[model samples]
Target chain A: MIRSAAGLPARAVEPVANLWFTWRYVENNLGDITTALSQHVTLTVQAVVLALVVALPLAVLAHRRPRLAGPVLGASGVLYTVPALALFAMIYPLLWDPRTTVLIGLVMYALLVLVRNVLVGLQGVDRGVVDAARGTGIGPTRLLLTVELPLAIPSIFAGLRLATVSTVALVTIGIIVGYGGLGQLLYRGFNSQYRAEIATATVLTLLVALVADLLLMALGRALTPWARGGR
Target chain B: MRDDDVLGAAIRWLNDPLVWQGPGGVLARTVEHLGMAGAAVLLAAAVALPLGVWLGHQGRGGAWLIPLTNTSLALPTLALLMIFASSGLGFGNRPTIIALAVFAAPPILANAWTAVREVDRSVREAARGMGMSSARSLARVELPLALPLVAAGLRTAAVQVVASVSLAAFVGGGGLGRFLVDGFGTRRYGQVLAAAVLIALLCVLVEAVLALGQRLLTPVPLRTGRGAVARS
Candidate 1:
């Protein structure tokens, strides 16, 4: 007989297939599952938004100064190299809340991609576009806003999409801090050798990543009607 | 809580003579970690290298695979390890290696595929004009030129495997993750930090070696600012 969480004996005879997925377990655990999912989405959104806020000014500054670009890109590469678990472990002792620690780690991981993409996109603004704007008596600020930034939107969106999906996947690593969202289920499932939890958690994490990527793609499409027409 | 005290405790843990001995020592764990990570990367390269190269030489169909591979680069490491280890594969290294190898393959495959295709058209034309067979042209002419990117992809895969091998601890596989899992389980925060430090250093070491290798692989002509500059 298998023991339940309450230490009661469960029926010894059960269908082997039931171990793979059980609708009853999910139906009863809706509250925990939903809570995990919401926390995951919340964590991913906050991290990406914060990363963009930080990456934007730095990207612009680097784009303006070629000398600064190398160091900026180099630093991001190093940051990205810091593995998720190691990053979390290093940060865990310094921070009080698990969520905040994870948030900081996720932001640092994303900074490299976001800054690199933004810099590339901005630099790619056709030199003729800037020259034409200047010839029409546009100020530098107006030139950047009207001509350069809009053109960079496609590349910027690409970075955001990547960052969002990766963060969704990486959020699972935050289980060390008890904040790994659906990763809680995965970890627990492993401890108990519960097939349904492991399978469901894995499938759900993929779904979350896929859904986030699709949403970002739709947002990008809506933002850039011109990208579609040009192709 | 005093952060300095935790740091001090971690320093103590790092220097402990006992922690450096026996089946569970830091040095042993590091070696285990490196061995497993290396195996995973090599395994991935074996499968991905041929497929990626073949698809790249074909030149048309595998365009779709790039995005698919990039997405797979974020394969949920923790979850996959658990699933594999539990799937009648028996506990420990077998399952962990399979999962880690799967995680490591995409970057290599994508890189090999893209690098082959990116070799200049004129270079291929020259190889053709020399009466080189398709196999010979791909082997002798295209691959050497594509070495820089292949090296880059290998470096990415290797570093990534080193970085994530700590997860093997979760599956009863002995490695540096042993320290992490044990420390966290026992609430020994200092040990956890010490393990983190060890892992980060390992990552840095792997990255340095790969960077040197990539430089050596890159021909003098292709060394023209592609890697150093952050251009798209």
Candidate 2:
């Protein structure tokens, strides 16, 4: 078997190199990592934020009309079931730019998870609480805003957490489309047989996901103080 | 670039008899994709089912297990696949299977764990009152009740593995994804479109089959209960 520079067999030519040594290579490519990380973060944040915007109205509509919930969820579920790599490839030709395709694909994937969570959160509000408020003549808009919305924050944040972590991971796959955060390193490193670069990229990508997850968890906790102990 | 042009070309490519008759044909690639994905799901189920069930029955370890599994969602499958491929695993099917198995395990584990744990404690107690041992109670009462959720987890893992295995082509593994890679490399837009369609159809099929299986596996009583309605 041909061996890579790291003395690893090059049978697949895509193996991860040694970690300590990979650190040196990673240091040398800090600038590239930074660029990719920024791009990755930008795409992830943008897709998720956009998904939240689009999903909220849909979720509200579904919540208001219980029957609409099934079709709304089913449509998003169909999108979610589409293979990520295939979806990106299918949309790539139409969009021309990898970034746009990645953005669209990520947004589509997030919609189902986010919308479902929002619906769950809204539906989870106790009927007794709603009835009590109604008995006091609380207006619909005020009730939805001050009571229901706050109650739903926890579930919505849970969805955000799930969406963010998965999106970060998915962004790495975007390397196939010519865009990825640390994913660029994995692909380039694979082609060049640089195991260290692959290791560095993989580690950083994981770290980014970890951090995003933790941040969202904290945000969820802060947003729903009542749920802190329960969580 | 027109939509109709791409659609027409893809349909033509898919219908061409020559595309299904050879070693690298769509038939072969579809089987390859199924084999790789199926192996991963099988592997994940093997590890996750027993562990999740045991933990759930014991009512222990969930505090840590759930979080750990949740955190694993952040691990990139491609990165994991590459690492396995480069580590002298000879890439393609072996390493790809291993990585895909790892990718597919979390959902099954988490779902199964939750499913068994969520089985009605009253049901378990009633079984025990009838002189059933702990193991017997779990097997007779809990397992039956938990089967639906366990099946749901299996369905989740199966769909995920099938969809993600497209990357196997990039890593020296045989699969329908090869068409996408090869097509993109050679600028054969038809092949790319065809591959995308096949992968999507494959995922949808797996989902439908599993949904049926889940429905069938559920106990009749459970199937008609509030729990089933809530889950659906």
Best model per DockQ: 1
- Shift of residue A46 alpha carbon in model 1, Å: 0.7
Off by over 4 Å in 1: A1-18, B1-4, B225-232
State the displacement of the C-alpha of residue B157, model 1, in Å, after optimal TM-score superposition. Answer: 0.7
Candidate 1 CAPRI grade:
medium
Worst 10 residues of 2 chain B by lDDT: B223-232
lDDT of 1 by residue, B133-172 (tens): 9999999999998888887888888988888888888778
Residue-level error in angstroms, candidate 1, position B74: 4.5
Q: Candidate 2, which segments miss by more than 4 Å at Cα?
A: A1-21, A132-138, A225-228, B1-4, B225-232
Q: State the iRMSD of every prediction, in order shown.
A: 1.2, 1.1
lDDT of 1 at A190: 92
lDDT, model 2: 0.84
DockQ of 1: 0.68
